[model samples]
Target: MNEITERDLLDFALLTDFESFLKHSMLTLNPGMPFLPNWHIRAIAYQLERVRRGEINRLIINMPPRHLKSITVSVAFPAFVLGHDPRQRIFSISYGSELSLKHARDFRSIVESPWYARAFSQMRLSRSLDDEATTTLKGFRKATSVGGVLTGLGGNMIILDDPQKPVDAQSKVRRDSLNQWFSNTLVSRLDNKETGAIIVVTQRVHMDDLSGHLMGSSDQWEVLSLPAIAEVDEQVPIGDDEFHTRRAGTALHPEHESLETLRGLQKDLGSYDFGAQYQQAPIPEGGATVLRNWLCWYDRPPERTTKTKVLLSIDAASKDGPQNSYSAFSAWQVQDGHYYLLNMERGRYNFPQLRDKALALAQRYEPTLIVIEDASAGIALAQELRSMGRHRVKAVPVERDKETRLFIQTSKFEAGHVHFPKDAPFIPDLLAELLAFPHGKHDDQVDSMSQALAHKFSGYTLDNLH
Candidate 1:
């Protein structure tokens, strides 16, 4: 009778599930180093299983850096798939050829190891045919750089790992080139469209990055988005049988990444890089135009004997089109050289809806001055409100561009004259837009706030106050 060894039991377990295979292979690859299993790793295993089973054709995963994303998706998963069927043709690419080739070597090492051979005895890699980045059993596994030529080569599975580096993410040329290559070249290199799978795994760099472009365009991809810190209570999938319930403000993986470590990372990386790489939002830090860490947070406005002048500033949007600018309304109570932001509302609304929201805010805040930017929709809304004669509505024309207006009000924020509510739900969105000023996708909030500050500080408006 043949001897039944520990290796035999381990091999059987690995073949049973991808998760088991991943854990076992990781141990084999990195001897003596303990495998720290986290929810993200489990989630990745589940997604990889879906890809293996042909349940999902396209998959995009966005997570923070140094989260073992590359190991799980680009390296081990490809090796695991090939272990099942060595004939499978896998094509992997990264921002550079060196990185892609490095991962390819790692995958090749895993498949060629004695443990892997024991687990998958039938699959064999021919030394004569295989190189550092390419493996040939029946078909072949190839790896290349993002812009590298794949003239006649195609793949059963295509893995794109960090197509653009963090520094290159801001370049329009680089971003456009990546998007074009993906759309024109990389996508067309699938061997069998009906059964082939494509996986994109990277941290969000910009609102128009490859991940963003894919997500915005179609619902074809199954996206597994994981931010460093939990923003809200959510039920996150780990594996088919396991699930992780994440609470707001909780660390993604407390064992590997504690709250203190993340906070230190935030301080080290700055707001832009931290938000983009860690939080996966890609909102850059406020520049010279708008100083970072400017606004002070307050639970309530300072108590004063003098009357508080509540002012409602409106920056209206002309149309309710999907891509059109949003209508922003900011209610500020000016008291003793400080502007306390009482409330803020922003949304995409048509003429009637805009009018209704303005009227509602006016009634709720009971503002002494309702300043509306004298633009297309603003002009109409101001006139309608003035005709009602319930509140004082002032229609002020925006003579300067958004940047100029924002620049004028930057001093107020720098001087710590602007304050925001401590626990407001809109605080994150407002701060993100402010911090990413001139670069972020939305600017309506900044425009409205600037107008409010400009109107408040202007000598003429102060002297002519009702």
Candidate 2:
């Protein structure tokens, strides 16, 4: 046997630690580019190590595009994981065949290189026609796209790199189909359900995209959300008891993107897209439809006078289940053609509970007119109230979608006609749903607000904010 040398010792080091392997193999896949040390890289490597040891079964990594996510996650990771455990089968997937093949090629290149052999000297390869590299140990790394299958096989570790193209994720039908594939087909491909690990590295496409769906799964996912710019302070753990302090307003990887550059991208991509893709928040600050600049704050609405038109708009929950949407109603007082929100209440309730809650609140606020969406429980509530000789209750049938209704009232919000209480408990939830709009999960508040605006001001005209 050959005596151990300095090079041999170095190879052992590379084989043992994820950071060592990742740092050294940076040049193995991409020959020319120098590795600029980023905190996110270390953080990701640490998390992957945890995954390998079965510490984390589910990992969702959300970062901005072109931020070394593809290189580190798809290319280097498969090579590194298989190096330590050559028997570990890896199924790598991407949004398209081209991307999946590209990752397969990169992983194959790294595993075939002299550096990889030095570290994993026992691991052997096959010069195969398929987009795969098999080890002598009977394990392989195979690449496939979103709908592509592995055919009656499963992997120890599955990596989904950009599961959906940004545009495709916007379509509800496409998104739902992808979600079904993930929840049904892909999930069933785990070699060992209890011990297998799933790593999903993607940019946030929509609020209901693959990442969002996985987040709601029973198996909890440790989300590493490194936005292009930090929205809040966070301590991203890189190693045991070691952390990278990410300050608010600071860039995630300054070497790759400066804060000013990210701002420029926001302008280029628009707030909604930039917010989802880069910011990872999926909604912009200062609101999307109802701009915060136009939001008028109030301690209280002007005392109810004969001129004030009290409108109670209830957007009932579609059903009475814990998982279903919350039945929400917002009370607004219109005075001098301006709508000031008085109060809002929302909760998961059946018909009787919802009716009682509405009537109790209505007793206190004493609304002159009430508008409810003409669907689900809203229809029944409107009928019951009308049967009680409450002719003020109007069940408005909606021909347009939720987004269209909100968009129609965009002018009213921008014209500074809508006002929200400064310190109301429900204000945060209301504004969050309003700003998140069509993308957010719960649009009950948005429905209520829009319904009130359409019914009360159908005959009125206001000057646009010019």
Candidate 3:
């Protein structure tokens, strides 16, 4: 391939009229848009195309604020999707009717624009249906003003556009209502076939706020996170050192002028708030029962070398072999004021599979005491483990609420006592749910941890004493 001349590049940039129209329309809304596509937008487009081809059913885009993310994904992108598939059903929702209507209007404007006419001459915007929001000749239908109007629709592309506003997103009641609306109303409207749902919003609140509820789910959900500051190493699961380094570098880089200004605006707001808004991290207070600063201050435990007394806690699944509960088996070595979270087994599993794992943990870690929560439908499985000659198999009952237990353990984690492996697979969910206390679901890991820790920290020595 020959190297294209600067003149040719510039000409091509201009000659790409349809692309220019798209860029110009976007510029009209956000003039200072970044030169390149952010990761979240790219991911959304990729998923949207896949859905158009009937690849995936659902997706969730949870990004930090002030990145011009919503306009790219929610407002303008729907029209773009319609360009590809005219018959697609699109429904967009926001916190309030007014905001939802505004997004719908934006979509209508794009479809009704002169540029739209010039680019796609045959296409025409459809009249608004009383039940349906709006439709276009491209066979794409869109609706913005919705609160509880998602019943009876099928094959609809549900766009939950910031269902919780900044203020409402922070409120537990408001978050619960929106989640309920999505579940009871919006999600119910989909046909028997796989439905497409897109949740695009700035990270205004907790992980469990809305996006967190959908984690580890196979019902067609993917979280597309884009932080304003690009981390140093730029890996998939970016680490702290590289994250901070890259964030600082992005703030100082001259080409990223607007991002630097955004950083300054964040500084004006406050660092923790900035972290929540722009870093795609969870809100410190919104469903965050445990303080992240305190958690970050604590360090991971040193790898075990010599023989150590260990307590293993298991939270078993209740229903399906794969879709039921996540079977998490965590081992803790309570010595020298350190709680080492040794191994974790989390995924869909049956009794036989879970039994095999229990045996494996016993053989591998040789735990002194085994604590399995005698909750959920698999209580008899605990007895089966004991019947199999698993030494020190203790089935402990978890009677306390998750919040109370988490509150008890939060103090320990803050005191630099609870240590988890940096690579523990369940660590992310554990930390996320622990911080996002009452609101987050699947408190199994935290519950098991709290039970084991409560047992240890309270100076209880008898195995299976609870």
Candidate 4:
């Protein structure tokens, strides 16, 4: 095609589609760089258009980093929205002042470009700056970092992009404070709550990070979580009624991040970090001792016999409170050199209540042996249970830490020697705790599980296990 015809076609596309506008803005900012197109960017643009059209008000996007998230949502989307409706006000937020300002400047440049004028002939900027822009109409674009002041100010679209840094996510105090700010300060700064839109764009940082906190709260939020690698067959919605059939183990954006590069990052960051940043799941799959996919799930174990060595492992907490850990126990049936988890329970209980529950469970399951970590509530509970000669109890001293114990038994779990009940009520908790080992909020379940494996297979004879 000729240059004028091509230019006319491009300008037409820029006015018609947000995805085309994103590509134009990307090229405008990065002069000589090639714009490698990906389906994820189109998906994000569709969501943003939905927001502009007032179809979606509250949206949460969790995806891997370096996928043009800021360019598309933070910078390009706002300018595109303003091109369509200059009366719309926008606010872009980030974890730091520098990133927020950078996004604002990029948005400003796109709006000020010569081609932008051709696409939106009616739109004109009356006042503009590196971090703020105002149009001829009563609309503006502003930037602010997390915890920045927005008193007496509101926007039609408030965009939160990476609200918490990776280091900040590790600190509960920081995460909680950021969450509180979003709930109290940010959410309140909506020009019109009925029609206003709020979009959060960030990678998964922790279990209780902004995404988790918002999702856990009573407030409703629509989540679009795109992991680096698909764990199972999925029909991910792109835009309109279209869906991308992402098969298992396929990369989300292979042009940007190949499978080889992702695996290298996983190896370097380890499962815990990779799980948060890349997988969009706070727990690792295979990097941790237990792989969720490798999990050997069984409906039930063979009929109990005298030869079946049943062991009960307990990791008890002294008190019952919101901050306190839950007292947990797992009953395993070791048969034919393989371990099958039969019964599991986790609850917050006082000492007397804890003792009664353990005794009752012991009586019910009639385990061959019961093991408890001699720490905190476990020591006293072990003494009480030991005094009751009805159950054979063994209090294993906490010579090593909980992670160390779980680490030592990693091979047995990965070797497919351990099995869990498929349809148990507590299966979700059990899998979540096991996969999140060494990093999750509560390690009580893992502690009890590792204690059981340690006591039963302490001999280190792989032959018996294999």
Q: Is candidate 2 or candidate 4 better by lDDT?
A: 4
User: Which ranges of candidate 1 are over 4 A from the true structure?
Assistant: 1-5, 128-136, 284-333, 336-430, 433-466
Q: What is the TM-score of each predicted model, taking all chains together?
A: 0.67, 0.65, 0.52, 0.65
Q: Candidate 3 — worst ten consecutive residues by lDDT sum?
A: 237-246
lDDT of 4 by residue, 128-209 (tens): 8777899999788889999888998988889999999988898889988999999888988997887889999999988889
Top-TM-score structure, candidate number: 1
lDDT of 2 by residue, 307-383 (tens): 87888899998677655777888888998988999888887799999898888877878887777888888889988
Candidate 1 lDDT for residue 233: 59
TM-score of 1: 0.67
Whole-model lDDT values for every prediction: 0.81, 0.81, 0.60, 0.83
lDDT of 1 by residue, 325-385 (tens): 8899999999888899999889889999999999999889888799988888998888788
| Stretches > 4 Å off in candidate 3 | 1-21, 27-44, 128-140, 151-155, 195-199, 216-219, 235-266, 283-466
Rate residue 201 of model 4 by lDDT.
Answer: 96
Better of 1 and 2 by TM-score: 1
Candidate 3 lDDT, tens digit per residue, 1-466? 9988875654454333223434645765556964543333344455555555566656666666544555666776666666555666676666667766666666666767665655444456567552244445435455544475555556566777666656666677877776677677777665553455554454645555677666633455655565555422233322212232223225322344466586565656544555555655654573366666565322555556654568888878786442245677777777766677776556556677888877888888888888788877448767787776756666767767778877877777778777666544345446655665665445667676777787653445444343
Error of 1 at 379 (Å): 32
